[model samples]
Target chain A: MTTDLVVVLDADGRALRGRAPKLASEQLTAIYDAMVRSRVLDEGASELGPDELSHYEPTHGREAIDVGATFALQDSDWIVPRKHQPAALLARGVLFEELANAWLGKIEDPTMGRQLPGHYSFRSANFLSTSSTAGSHLSHAVGAGIGARARGDDTVFLTFCDVQGTSSNDFHAGLNLAAVHKAPVVFVVEHAPWEASERETASATIAAKGAAYGIPGVRVDGHDVLAVYRACREAVDRARRGDGPTLVEACTWLTDGDTPAWRCEDPIKRFEQHLAHQKLWDAAIGQRHFDTATAELAEAIALARTAGDPDTESLFDDVFMNLSPQLREQRRELARTATTTTIQP
Target chain B: MTATETRPGVKVMTMIEAISDALRTEMKNDDRVVVFGEDVGPKGGVFGATAGLHEEFGETRCFDTPLSECGIVGAGVGMAVYGMRPVAEIQFLDFIYPAFDQIVSEAAKMRYRSGGEYTCPMVIRSPYGGGIRGGHYHSQSSEAYFCHTPGLKVVIPSTPADAKGLLISSIRDEDPVMFLEPKKIYRHGKGEVPLGEHTVPLGRARIARAGTDVTLLAYGAMVPVCEAAADAAAEQGRSVEVVDLRTLVPLDEQTIVESVKKTGRCVVVYEAPKTCGYGAELAAILAEKCIEYLEGPVVRVAGFDTPFPYTLEHLYMPDEKRVLAGIDKTFAW
Candidate 1:
């Protein structure tokens, strides 16, 4: 079945009379800035040539879905991002230097360069590390949501995935468990427009699949930042009010082609035009945001390049609460065979 | 004999009852403890290992889940990470294949991968090993698979007392533990158990019987088998030391190496296949740490490298006869 796309903005960036001022002017400008920054980072990251680093799929055109869904969450709420969505971390205020160092597998990364690039995690920010395996983090989100309810904390968990991820058994298992237990979770699916063949072969729309698990499903125009934000805000509110999960499918076009039409459809560009129409954006303001983001990213890249690799002796850290006798012996053997170097504490 | 007391003033129970008691005690002490699996609630578990938990803890805490092993374990990992002590059952260790990814990839690696930011403090319990005519599907010693994975604790209890104590420790541990119950002796192995708050710590091996002639290292069902073999060796005027390695992953290397060093002869016994089995690890450790102390080559008495057989179950398992033969061969060598 075909689900209608929920849109709140017209082609000319005019909102309906009642919903025009739902978001404060400052919030809208911040969302636009975040989108621009994310787009710039993605473009620069993609330009970094092969240097023994694993390349992650760029979140080039899906900035609105990333920033909107993340901005709607409270500090207590949790977000489990997919492996490719670096914007989720950027929206959560992760430092660009940390992201750069993590991508370079340097010692300064929080995970000690263990995780791949774009798979960011910050416990203090309530953002879970992305699991490389598709659909694995869905159940973890459900569990966290249930845990929140059990602790009498009205915290909601939001997870992001793609159209193909819904086909995994873990996806169904998580949704079923959440529906049965009334877990406070929101599953946001970025339904890329280029996946028409995938959608055609599927039995139903990704949103409709939520109904089978007794969850409320809503589809939105992903390019419209206000629409996506509104849908996610409603879902988060419902979850905090003891209602079960909601599956939000943000239908978006993949603007990967080097064409002007694709560039025009960019979520960042669309939001910028909308802000300009509202007199909140101009050439000076746009240039300031661009310059700040470029300078910050350049500084982060330089810092990451100077960071050294993790010490060889530190390979046995964090494997368990404490190293067992076997591990201690193994570490000793490794220390004896390796060149001695000072390890960071 | 009265069912109440096998030994005066002491309660004698089977290994299964000891496991149930451990779960009950932990659930009573800590409200975060939860138990769930297929047929574990109203049906009281397929083997009655969780017989009274449902009636006592109520449906919310002790419940049944869909027959999805992956979901059962994956949810357990999530719950543990979210600050719940979940005790998930897999019915049989043979059925744990579907949940292997969740156990190895997610649960085991949660702390390490998250750089110690998150941890999965959960316990996965399943009845394992051959005997009782369970054939291939129902009976298989799969401890080696989990022991090979880092960041996971693997435990096996041989007697009723160890079952109660070790399980309590596993539930209270701050890491994911794979508790494999020896189904072969779950009912037949009854012993006097210490009542109330008894906990045998993980990574400690117990000397069932001390001797100087040979060191017989074993765990799980093989513990009793090796004990019997020690008794047989005593009849021949050869003293045999039996060391029960209750936990495999965090192996008590000091105890194992010390025992082999003192005896100068070692025989490792397990019901799993010989090649690349947990016994191989014991042999390698012995070779690495106690090679000079050994007067003979380290021997292994284990099941054949084949699927667990149905009617030939008795022959496939490592019995007292095979263990004794291994001891004698090592002495001759």
Candidate 2:
């Protein structure tokens, strides 16, 4: 399963000679900070609600893929997440307060409490709105690629999906269409085989599937943040140059990272060790980033908790560009019910 | 901009030609408008509704897509969200089921789900209805499916002129539009259409033939049948009115209600199945609003509750005769 994977950092956080990406000390620190913020938010959301955190805990080990791939993308590039990628969203400039509001479904939430905790739509940051249905956003990425090219810009589109997304119908349709149309898109799959067994997918790695669609596929160690960045940056560069799409498989696992072996695979600790090896890590700086992230998450959650629920009247908004006459009547009917509530008492 | 005003010249065209004219007019005016679907490029669509668009607009603006309806629609949603007005043809309404999720879930909900920051101002133009001997796979009127979904504007034009204008208006609309073209009347429904920049606003109905005794409501290909039935009813001294409801979602309820209240009778007609068909909604609206003005029960002249058949499509379709009978039911009541 580890065939031809581009590995930069080992399990012990030692960088392979000449394989690590050339990033400045600040850039490295920022990437590490984003990963820590993601981890903190993931843990902090548990205090928001256990029912919401249930969906966030199992997919915690793949923070490297989220932050690494996001760092490789430019500000103009669009991000279509197959599922929740809070680390990626945060790296793309989404505010922690907004993310917290979305999780709490507060009135100030940009989505107006329409979606679940992790189903985000931050258009200001070029993040596409996500849905609960799997594989639906794949073709949207391809379409965005075509659209960006059509606008006569070099903007690229990056999408993150799970390993099982390869088996969906939209996966084939999106890849084939992107290749056929030479769309500027990069498909990155966090290849954590949670559902598919080894016997079922043992014949070939998920990266090889790109060849059938006439696109190049590269496999990378998902836990190695630099490795994922290198692979995704190359793909992004190729796509922006009008070379069509490239599929990058960031291979990791779905785990809680509590056990000894799983702990070694922690993307955050591995990156901290790499920073310490480069004489860039210190106890004070590490504690500052962790505390800052924790405090930010706590403050955001606290503020979102104080906000009221979305106004009931806003439910009728955004159904169309303008509310039709029929909708106007319906809104009036809802208002009547609201006014009549006091009369009943 | 709304092109309610048009040039002086007018040209007689079939429904298909009017549709092509609308696409060409919009693409020429706005560079953001793109037309693509299966066989839409060099083949000019299976029904030639997109004829000469690829040659005129080039491959980037008007091109072909893979044989996946979901890909076609999903890509259109993406392009629209990226600030392009894409008109994606689904070949036929029957084949649109595969892309139904992309249509209802992605395209329709993009505006509301994104909190109005993102929108899918795209058009999904598909040929529908059970004429042309196309049977179930090629035919079948499925506008009711899209009409039921919120955030989507379902439009079915009855005349060639209305087709061009309505298609243009749908292209310019801010929400997702299900531009259901009647394949049955693609060529047969011919009339004088404006040369350029004509717009028939949505959520409005046209009085095809004014009368007093009864009001017959229909859209798309069925509008012509209702008109013919109204003409026949006129000869029998029945004075029937034919109302062409161009857009179904932001519905022209005022016009339909006014027409029904004036006539005191209503006959709803459609080519789809009778059970839970669009005609049922029309009947219910009439029953709710125009109940006191009604002189009879709201009769629906529609296809029987059966799959569209190859040989027996004639019996399955509600034609001039069936509509006339429906008119008689309103009179008898």
Candidate 3:
């Protein structure tokens, strides 16, 4: 309900001139460690894939928005992510190898090499597929919430979009439908206008758009993992209680704007500083988490490389529940000549 | 779950009534079955195809949605992915363009893109084709667009019985289905439909008439026109076989090839535009599989390549005489 930007930890990772939310040491450390792990995976993934597939949009400083918001929800809740967030997937219990499989476009992945890199889906974790279409996941999240409510389940659906994504028609229709039906959906908009220089043209607040749709809007400092978690937790609780949707706009930056130091604006460093202030983290703990993340990434990449590409005949599969006679014939024809390579004379 | 069991007895119903009965029957049997779209609840849809559903199943199961076709289809895809069999209604097929991205990109590809971990078990019901005197905005037969999508099942029912049966199968299928209703024949005739639990399998064609001279391949509203043309062909001492291709994606190619191979001549009838229409796919299949058995080139009796006209709709849509002329072309050649 508060339109003001909610900040718990300042840029120095120290408490600001306000009451900060309390959390258990383990919970705080877990959130911080997950953010660290995600940053490591992001760096590793950038260079892990083969050839042209190595390119990826690294989640350099948006760890808090991914890990923190996900930390607020339960395992039964659904996470509908538009962009790839390794932190969120890790928090949802997705294995590092599964992520590597998806990044490598291997058959072991849930999408079975059908999707491009970063378009992952883990049904066991209740994580929906990452849609490439901007703002389209908003309505799907709302519909998932509505469907769960109709089935008498209290599963909340959490979805995210960026400032530019708010301009899509689905954003308008999704929020309006969620509010009208009082669906259990929490929309999290990571407003980082600094990523795109042209994004500076629009000075409007993403949270303010929720007011026109009759939903409570709250803004939080995206760098502060605790602040994002608290705001998302409240929204999740509100949705679970059938009070309707809430839009939590987490304002963040891709890097330190005023200061040249990455530690000043890095979400993982800020959360680590907070943990240090709480006397729950130190260099040894940080090094151990970093080593674990690096080792896991190495193992995942190794296993992913061992896996072969999907079968050529699988190209015709999954187009429908059962392959029709037409696709069956196509699959047979593909298998016949798919292995033959023509050599130029 | 099981093969559709049709209990004894039948009730004479129109295509619209059959559609309503299908919705009611499926919603009654499966609590997960939901019927929704703009004006589908209280208004029972613009054509009354979903009439009495709201009263029968209440708002949760049967309700109206916002007027956004994209929202209706996209949300239905979400619901279906979440384990609900959503039978979403699009007032008219011409209005489905706004949801085309959702239909092709999201719903159709949900299962494939997700590697079967997630599936979209839903049916999108929409009235299609000309003869309703509607202008271009409301009368275009756009099923060809959906038929081109690999994962989507494009089904068109000509008779009331098939409308009810195919709809039931569509609802239970573990993939998305485009149940394009022929609004032109929504109430043209009443036929004896099974009382309850009658289901027709997808990807199968029905032989409307048996013949030995020429075969008329058609679907939806054109099925009746092809049959009537067969009667007219019989007067000229030529037996014309009419094949109703129920589902266009899987496309009863077996039956189509078999019929054409027997008849040695083929005429494809459709209400969509001639260029790149569904009839083109049919003719290609006939040429690919039955060319050796053919006696002449395949003729296509379809709507013009121009936009659907309001005032000149009767002239634009192919009638029985037009189909007969197509048959005569095959015989003359």
Per-prediction TM-score to the true structure, in the order listed: 0.93, 0.95, 0.95
Tens digit per residue, CA lDDT, model 1, A140-168: 88777766665677888999888767877
By TM-score, the better pick of 1 and 2 is: 2
Error of 1 at B207 (Å): 0.8
Residue-level lDDT of model 2, residues A1-345, one tens digit each, is 454878898877898888888899889988998888888887786665565433553346788998999999999889988768788888876778988888877888788988877888888889988887768899999887787787797989999787667777788889999999999999998877454635335535678889999999999888889999999999999999888999998877423333212233688889999998988887788899989989988888788878887777678889998998888888777777785322211
Off by over 4 Å in 1: A1-3, A16-21, A193-201, A253-264, A343-345, B1-10
DockQ of 1: 0.63
User: lDDT of each structure?
Assistant: 0.84, 0.86, 0.85
Model 3, A1-345: lDDT tens per residue?
Answer: 223778778776887765466677777877877787788887787675357365477777788898889999999999988867667988877778988888888879888898878788889889887778878888888888878888999999999988767877788888988898898999998877444624532535677778888899888878888889889998999999999999998877422444322233778888778778878889998999999989998898898889988866667778988989988787766666666422111
- Select the stronger candidate by DockQ from 1 and 2: 2
Q: Write the per-residue lDDT of candidate 1 for residues B1-333, one digit (tens) a residue.
A: 212475654678888888888898998999888898899998889989888889988876787877778778877887888789989999999999988888998899888777778889999999999887999999999899999999999999999999999999999999999999989898885788877789999999999999999999999989988999999999999999999999998999999899999999999999998899999999999998889999999999999999999999999999989998999888897
lDDT of 3 by residue, B1-333 (tens): 112334457877888998888988999899999888899998888999888889888889988888888888888888988888889999999999888888998998888988888899989999999988899998999988988997999999999999999999999999999999999899888888897799999989999999999999899999999888888889989988999998897788889899999999999999999999998988888888878998988999999999999999999999998998888888886
Steric collisions counted per model: 0, 0, 0
Task: Report the error of model 1 at residue B10, Å.
Answer: 5.4
Winner on DockQ between 1 and 3 is 3
Query: How does model 1 do on interface RMSD, in angstroms?
Result: 1.4
The TM-scores of chain A alone, one per candidate, are: 0.92, 0.91, 0.91
DockQ-based CAPRI category assigned to the predicted complex of candidate 3? medium
